[model samples]
Target: MVRATMMSKQQIAELVEIARRDHTLWAALKDRELDQFNQDGSVKIPSISILVEDFVKERCGASHNYAIGSLIVALRLPIRQELGLPA
Candidate 1:
């Protein structure tokens, strides 16, 4: 049998906050990339996955699994919004 460690509500909230901040930064980076791409038909911005991994490593010093899991959970709202789903 495998045991799972669950984060407390406060921990989850903190993760969400981190995610939101990273998301905002990611959006700005993407917008910049879009503008650059429009201007020259090329993009040089790093991938969002790489950005999130770096952010989580720098901010939380947590494992890759934790970082990815938090990002997936955090991105749910934004993904839904992008898909035109109800919040």
Candidate 2:
């Protein structure tokens, strides 16, 4: 199951902005090969590694919490656009 982290909305926004501009960052976030799920079949978000944490922090001065929320927000963009939903 994915761990939960507390983050400010502004931090999430900043991380999203950074991911949008950096393809490497974008790829890291978009990739979900390591995802786990709960007994209810809901996705269980995995924790971020130190390396990924550092990379994101380096770009947006955000912490793991920010990355957690930003990842959700970031991942949704492509899906939303693909489905013709507002992004």
Clashing pairs in 2: 2-45
TM-score (all chains, Cα) for each model: 0.45, 0.41
Candidate 1's error at 76, in angstroms? Answer: 4.5
Off by over 4 Å in 1: 1-12, 22-26, 29-44, 62-67, 79-87
lDDT of 1 by residue, 5-86 (tens): 4545576567656656666765753454334344576664555456655766676675533525555456555645655666
**Cα lDDT over the full model 2:** 0.55
